[model samples]
Every structure is written in structure tokens, then in C-alpha cells.
Target: MTAPTARIAGEESARDQGLARGVGLWSFTFSILNGVVGAGIVALPASMAAAAGGYAPFAYLAVALVMAAVVVCFAEGGSRVPTSGGAYGTVEAAFGKGAGFLAGIYMWLASVLACGGIAAALCDALGALVPALAGVGPRLAILLLILGGISWINVRSAGLAAGVIAWGTVIKLVPLGLFVAVGGLALLVGHDPAPAAVAPQGGHFSEAMLLALFAFCGMETPLGASGEVADPTRTVPRATILAMLCVLVLYVAIQVVAQGLLGAALAGSAEPLADGMRQISPALGLVLLAGGILSRFVWIGSDVLGAPRVLFAFARDGMLPAWLGAAHPRFATPHIAIWVHSAIAFALAATGTFTRLAILSTLATAGLYFLACAAALVLRRRGVAILGTPLSFRILPLAAGMGMASMVVLVAIARIDEILAFVGLTFASLALYAVMRPRIARAA
Candidate 1:
């Protein structure tokens, strides 16, 4: 028993050593930025304006405050687990395989759906640019090219993927920065900043928050690649906190500029940011439209870099076939995993509308966050050791509880159909876990 156990442990260590730790603090921070600031910033301004009139920015603020606590919980979990499965690893460590598997599905689905939703949005922007290509044929072709190309890059190298994301972040932010600077200046000069509509009434505020939450939801998916991160305990929390801060500030600024510039017309504009930019210059408005398209392309690249690792991790840990976990000897990356998920994402992007996919992804991520917060308390109580230097701030229970409560509230207020789909997925995960339990134990 001792000899066999030693041999088994050795094999597991060999498997664990497969992935590269190419993602450092800055790279990981950029990953967080790349992950969070995708199509949400590009396309949601009008939706937000419609939901809350001029008060839309406050809804973003409201959600951010609650999500901040959730981020702390995740930061703590990331430090402790610091593995590829990310939230899956943290949750599994606290509970059992069954619970971990369920959380993993949520993490994986959230990434795929978000990527698909953004992909659809990208095509929509393209359609706007070239009305001739607005038909389904062109949209499908575009998604194929972007998804196929980006997934190839990911299969080749994690470092290469990170580089793409890091640079992509700067490129996408340019138009947004210009809009805020130029639009904000114009507003100050002689702008009528009053909103034509009143504060969010009826269920409008609730709806506003749902959109705001989507803007914030994609940030956490990158944490699924914690194993690729160098010195995760040092890197994860710092990078996550900094990126989340940037997201909050940037989102608020964009909302303010768009609102003040467009005023009463903000809600009615299909292209709020573009319209606001056009008020100053038509050429600038075109830039914003092009920026939206570029943002989605970059976002899909980031999704490939970070999300497929969840599949690789699952395969590595024996939750699924070992082939899914197998790193390509030539590239030292999870090529099979990347390809498999890319295919699924493409299909979803082809079939689903942006709004439907965004709502589904948001609800999935919120549920995942709620579970992770609960896992944080369990991990602390179980004395899960930090993978590197300990955090300076204490992991307060109040914060964990608040995060959990916030997620519950988020899910509770979403459309009933979305809630039902979430529940259905949860049950499906449990059923699959039970069936796979024997294989899981054998792998363990």
C-alpha cells in the first residue's frame, strides 16, 4: 500500500508539472482587465440608460460595492488554492468532489456563455459598420475566423495568449478614454446634463442592476487559470483588487460621459457611446464603433487564454477524461481542452442572441460567486494554507457573509426563466457528479 501510494502520488505530481506559470502579476492583472472590460463596456451603455435614465451609473456603483466584498472572498480563495481549477479547487477542498464538480460547471459555463455573448455583439457591431454583412452568413463567418484564430494562439502558448490580452486591453481602452475625455469636456463647456427621465421606477432599478452586474461578471473567470499564474498568493489578490478598481472607475466615467452628453436621448440611442462621440465629431463616433468591434475580438482572445484552463484542470484532476487534461508536448499547452471549448463557444455564439447569453452568463457567474464565498469560510476554518506569503488583511467573516447575501439577492431578482435555468443546471451538475464519482475516486 505504501509503495503503490508513493508511486501514484509521483505520477500526480508529474501531471501537475505540465502547465507553465507564464502569467505574472502584471500579466494576470491585464488578464483581469481583459476579462472584465469586454463587450459589456462597448454595448451596454444604452441598455443601462434605458433601465435607469441618468441614474444608471449609480446602479453600477451599487453592484460594485457588493461585488467588492465578493472579490475579497475570491482573492482569499485564490491565495489558498492557487491551482488551475480555481474556484473549483477552492470549493472542492472545502466540501467534497460532488460540490467541486458543480462549481466547476458553473465556472466553465459562465466563461463559454460570456464569450459567445460577446462574440454575437462583435458581429452586431460589424453589421452596423457594413450593413451589407448584416446577414447570418457573414456573422457566422466572422465568428469562425475570430474563434478559430484565437483558439490556435491559445493552443500554441499561454504566454502568447497573455501578450495578446495585455496589448488588447490598451487597444480597446483607447476609444473609451477618448469618449470620456472629449465627451466630458463638451458636457462641462455648455452641455445640458439633466436626464429627461426620472429615477428608475417600478422594477427598472432591478433591471438596471442586472445590466451593471453583467459589466462586472467576466472579471472572475480569469481566476480559473490560477495555475498559470506565477506566485499566485502574491499575484492573485493584488492583481484582482487593482483590476476591479480600474473596472469600477472606468465604467462609472463612461456612464457619466454618455449620460451627460446624450441626456434625454441616451436611452433611445442604439449606439449611446457612438452617438455621444458623434455629437463632437462623426469621425470620433466611427472610432467608437470600431472600438466596440475590436473590444469583442480581444475579449474572445482573453476568454481563450483563461477559460479553457478550467477544462484542462478538470481533466488533469480526473473529473473528466485524461485526454482533456493532456498538454500538447510540442507547445506545452492544453490544446485539446482549448479546441473542445472553442467549438462549443462557437456553436453558442452562432445560435444565441447577445441579451439572452449575457443574462445566462451573469446568473451563472453570480451563483458561482455565492458558492465560492461559502467555500472561503470553509477553507479558512479547515486551515487551508496559503500557497505563498499570507495576505496582510484579515479574511473577515462579515465580508464573506455579505458577499454570499449579495449573490443571493442578485439571482433572486433576475428573470424567472434565468433563475429556472440556473436551478436546472445545478441539478444536472449534481447528477453528473454522482455518476462520475467512481471514476473520480479512482483518479484520486
Candidate 2:
């Protein structure tokens, strides 16, 4: 009996060592892209136009370059650790468990709030298409429906979630790609793209550039699933680079077309992409609306897949309930964590507005970025190595420095309320950690 029990325990341990590792290069790339390119991409041109006029495209370009440094830093740290929890795990490796818990909590809060906002946005987007859903009750119902469906898919299988996100990304890009192609061709044939390239102001450009950062928020998402990724050291970095390039191409093309077609009108329009597409053709406007719905789903799906993994990581570390660490025996997915995250997010969706949650999410994500960058510097200095050959780009220190500086700039630009919310969350995390320390020590 003892021998059989030992064998069973060994088998369970072996299964626990593997997090499915089903995520391939392409799927991983899509995950990063899905994280970075959310529904915000569609109307972002308008916001940029309002803020920077002719310099809006340049703002996008500059922000992308700055964000690249941050991504590189994350890539470096992820390669060294190549585990779940993303910034949380990396920071824990460098700083210690307490720091990791704090980082993980920030990320979890950010994703949960962002998920709520996405659901609310999804409801609004659907309402625009179907007037019947304009009422609060109907919208809330739809939000619940969306969350339920996504949670079901995620709890069933991580591979399925990856597949859905990848295919959803492809689908989401179609309308934007078409607009870019048509608009770019028009520009090539002696047509001026921007009819209103007004002089840009420094103040407006600064604000717009900061706003553009929102479009690139999800670059660290793929890292959250590192345990599930095959050859994470190589795959994570390569996927990060590829996803960035893809978004850069798409963003540049879309911005140019949107700027050219809408000109000054882009600044004030509610549906910027649809307005720009309408200028090309009325039919294209409808395409933009349809695409917006698809993009929202992709955004929510990305968050759903990411946040729960962080919770799973916390549980595995004994920061949360131990059951959350358990993957579904059949599906090998973190079913318990996913359901809990979905439930809380759904509650937020029902009660919260998008603007409030967006502000909080932005601040939380910026905080996470600061920690991730700082961890990169610390880990490299300490010279830690994982079991596998870690990826190295030789610019880790530089990348970390730049990434930290960029995050500081971001934090400075953030609103006062956001800063306050971040501080509050940090305190809350500390309190929770203090209470859980004894239990965690015993578990360890």
C-alpha cells in the first residue's frame, strides 16, 4: 500500500511539473499581440489626432520604441525564470516572495479591473449595434453572458483558449488591414493622406503620446503563461518581438490612413475608425463596427486567460487558496482560479463603469512594469540561472534602465486619483501578505 501511494504521488508530481506546455510560437505570439492590441486601437487614432494633430503618428511611433525597451527587459527576466506569474515570478526570483506577492497582487487587480472595463465596453459596443441592449439591464445581462461563455471555454482547456485568441486576433485585424490597404493605395497614387495636418503643440503631443501607451499595455501577457509555453526562453522573446512588429505595422498603417482620411475631424469623432472608414466607403463603416465587436472579445479573452494564471501562480506559492493551484484533472487547466476571477470580474462589470476601472487598470499595470524592470536589473546583477539555457540579448541592463525610466514618466503623467488608487492597493496587498505569512511559512 505504501509503495502504491508513493507511485501515485510521483505521478502527480510529474504531471504538476508540466503546465501542458501546449503553447507554441505562433500561439504565444498571438497572445502577446492580443494583449497589446486591444479594442483601443480602433479609436486611438482619433484621440491621438485630437492631442497631437499631425504628430499623432509620430507619437505612436515613439511610444512603440519606448515600449520595446520595456518588452526587452521583460523578455530577459522571463527567459531566466520561464515560469508562471510573469512579473510576479521574475520579481520574486530577484527580490523575494513578499515582493513577488505584491507584484502578483497588482497584476491580478489590474487584470480584474481591466476585464470589467472590457465587459462594460463590450456591452456598450453591442448596444450601439443592437439598440435593444442600450438599457442597463440588457447590457448587464449581455456582460454576464460574455463572461460566462469565455469562462466556460477557458475552464475547459487552455489550448482552446489559445486557439480562440489566435483566430480571434486574425479576425479582428481583417477590417483594419483592409482599411490600411485601401488607404495606403490611395496615398501612393498622388493623393494626400492627411487633409488636415495642422501644426502640433508640445502639450498636446505629450498627452497624446501618453494616451497611446494604452494601446501597448498587454506586452507582458504572454509571459503570464510562461509555464504553459514550449521552450519559453526562446519562444517568449521571439514571440514578443514578432508580436511587436505585427502591431507596429498594423498601427502605422492604420494611423496613416485614419489621419489622412479624417484629418482634423478625427479628433472629435466618437467612432474614429468607423468615421475614417465611412470616408472611404459607407460599407466600410459597418465593417469597422463588426470588427469592434470582435476586437472587444479578443481583449476580454486575453485578460481572462492571463489574470487567472497569475492567481494560479499565487496559489502555487501558497499566497492564496491551495485549490487554485490545482489544474483540472481532465483539462489540465486552472479551472478553479479562472472561475473565481470571472465571477469577481463579472460583478465589477455589472456595477462599475469603464472610465473608473480603466484609470485603475492603467495605474496598476504601470506599477507592475516598474517592478518588472527593476527585477530585470537585480536578477542580472545577481547572475541567476535556470535549468535551461536562458535567452540573453546583452542589453538587459540598458533595457531595464530605460524601462524603469519610462515607467516613471508614465507614473508622473498618471492622474492623481489613479496614483491614490495604486497606493491604496499597495497597502492592501501588504496587509494581506502580513496576514498570510504564517500560513505560507508553514506550507513552505
Candidate 3:
């Protein structure tokens, strides 16, 4: 009996170890969804209005289409490798270790910068709801506190971190869905805003469209967690596509409702959706605003889960410290990597400029996506099998590449400073890589 019990425990331990390498399919889907629909949605209407005028809905649709293309490209690449590092791993495999190191650094910096943006946004929302902490000093302190709390959750355990993200995502989605449904109902009841209220003005289509694209950033977060997913090939693709579709529907519907409810006002308002909902029901507006704050928490949680996995993957490949590649003995999670990510995220959140951070983060991610699509083309041309699957570079990869390239161009036109920031950050990454290469190789 004792021998049989020991055998059972050993088998269970092995199973746990294997499972720790990836998460279940539903968990993967939820993680992706959580990553895609963050605090940006709260700011979407304002960004769209700034670019597209009243035609924010159309801009959203266009953004969704572009995002879909990117999603398809990610699906192809992610399905092939399904590793923790995502774009870094794919690019490394397609190119070489040097390129992989650069890609991983870019992605890591992006994730950390994103964490700062999310933390700032969360603090802003909290300050708005609590007037006592509305001052800059208090808000910054609150932001630090929030970052600390989130970091603690992340380092505690993978399941706990993922569970937090999963639940937070669901909670945030409910209000967004409600806003869409209620807004659609209002439109059906002949409460639609005037066409002038929803149409783009002065032919600023390109600018508005680019801003919309920005709103759809983070759609490929699931790929970052591919290493932790149960079935990377099937689950990563399905989860990526599904998360994007969900975000698209919610974004478009929300835009339509917001435009109808506030018209040109939606374009100018910082909290457009909340303001629009206020027009419908002040109580609901408050509720949605509260939800937006919670959504930021969800975003942070998802980032904490996803970013460390990328580091872990890079570490495994000798691009970083091998110790970072160590999985938890009991939990089978990347505990060390998680702590390192949280520490960096906390430092950035505590001190970084939000605008600069946001721009750098977005640009870095966009650049990586562009490279992933290009790599897909390269792999297809070389007749390489991606994860035992046949490689094919169809129109989707080209479209995705072009779309991302256009976005990069548009961002350059609209915000050159941000582009420069991305460039500067890339240079910093390269410097770190140069300094660490020897040590990484020696450790490997």
C-alpha cells in the first residue's frame, strides 16, 4: 500500500510538472481576452473622435480589420512555436540568436512600459473616484501602492495570478457588454445621434484611423503565454482570434453608442464612454467608470502573467540569466522571472512619464508584430515547418505586415517623439544585450 501511494504521488508530480509548462485552453483564452481589452477601451472614444470625428464606429471597424490581420499572422507564428517568448522566439528561430536577443529585449521593455501606463491609468481612475487623492502626489503614491499589490499577487503563484486576471477580465467585460447592449437598444428605439455627430470631419481619416489602431494594441498577448497554454498550436490560434473578435464587437458597439449618446462631444471628452453612459444613466456611468478602474487591474494582472513568461523563454535560450529560466519546484511556474518582471514594472510605474511610456510600449509592440509577420513570410519561403505544421505565407501575412507598417508610418507622422522614444529604447536594449551577451553565453 505504501509503495502504491508513493508511485501515485510520483505520477501526480510528473503530471503537475508537465501542466505547469502550459495552462488549460479556457485559461489561455481568458488570459488573451484579459490582455486585449484593457484600460485603452475606456479611452477609445476620445482617441477615435480625435482622429475620425463622429465616425468613430467606422474607425473602430477598420482597426478591428487591421487587428484581425495581425491576429492571423500571430496565429501562424504562435502556432508554430507556441513558446513563452512569442515574437522573440519566432524571430530567433527564423533569423538567429542575435536577432532573438534584440527582439526579446524590445518585448521586455514594452511590457514594462505598458505596466507603467496601466498603473498610471489605474491611479488616475482611482483618483477620479476618490477626490481626496486627486492631487498629483497622492495619485502617484496610489499608483505605487497598486503596483506593489499587483506585483505581490504575481510572485505568489501562477495560478493565483492567472485566476486574478481571469476573474477581473470577466468583471470588466460585463459592463462593456452592458454598455453596448444598452446603447444598441437606444439606437434601435430611434434615439440615434445625427449623422454629422458620427461622421469624420475635414478628411482626417488617416489620423483617426491610426488612433483607432492604437486602441486595438495588445491583441496578441495570448501568444506571449503560448508556453503556458495546454495546446499551443490549437489553443493559441483559437484564443487569439476569439479575443480579437470579442474586443472588436465590444469596441465597435461601444463607439456607436457613444457617438449617438454624445456626438461630437464624444470626440473631445477624455472619458467618452463614461460620459456617454452618463447621458443615458448617470448611475450606470458611475458604474462603468468604476469598471474601467477594475479593468486596469485586470490589464496589470494579465501583463504580470504574460511578460515574465517571455523573459523565461529568453532565459531558456541563453538570451538572459539561466536562473530566470528556473520553474517553481512545487508550482512548476517561472517564479524568478515573475519577480524580476514585477520589480522592473514597479520601478517604471513609480517613476516613468506616462505619455512617453505609453508611446514607447506601443511602438515596441507594433515593431515586433511587424517582424513576426515578416518572419512568417521568411519561414514560408524557406519551406520550414512551423511546429510540425506546414508553413504558408498567404495574403493574410502580407496584409498584416502592410497594415502594421502603415501603422508605424502613421504613428511616425502623428507622433515623431514617440517613435524616437521607441528607437531610443531599442538602442538601450541593444546596449544591455552587448554587455550581457558574454555572461549569458557563459551561463548557458
For each candidate, the alpha-carbon lDDT, in order, equals 0.80, 0.76, 0.69
Colliding pairs, model 2: 193-260
Better of 1 and 2 by lDDT: 1
Ranking by TM-score: 1, 2, 3
Greater TM-score among 1 and 2 belongs to: 1
How many clashes in each candidate? 0, 1, 5
True-vs-predicted CA distance for residue 181, candidate 2, Å: 1.2
* Candidate 3 weakest lDDT stretch, 10 residues: 4-13
Model 3 / residue 402 / CA error / Å:
1.9
Which lDDT tens digits does candidate 1 get at residues 368-414? Answer: 88889888887666656545444534745887889898888888988
Clashes of 1: 0
Candidate 2 residue spans exceeding 4 A from truth: 1-16, 19-27, 152-166, 189-207, 228-233, 321-340, 347-356, 388-394
Q: Which stretches of candidate 1 lie over 4 Å from their true place?
A: 1-28, 152-163, 192-203, 225-235, 321-336, 392-395
Candidate 3, lDDT over the whole model: 0.69
Q: Please name the candidate that would achieve the greatest lDDT relative to the true structure.
A: 1
Q: What is the lDDT of residue 262 in candidate 2?
A: 74
Q: Residues 1-444, candidate 2: write the lDDT tens digits.
A: 234323423433343384687899998897787677787777567667777887878887988877888888788878776776567778877777798798878778878987887787678767767889989889878977899999999988878997898788789878777878876676667554435445434356656666667667777665767878888779988898899888888887788787777766677655667767777678978898789788878878877887898888678867887888999988888989999999999988888766556656767777888899888777666665453666676887788788788877876776787777778889988898888898788876
List where candidate 3 sits over 4 angstroms from the true fold.
1-30, 192-207, 227-235, 309-356, 391-393, 400-404
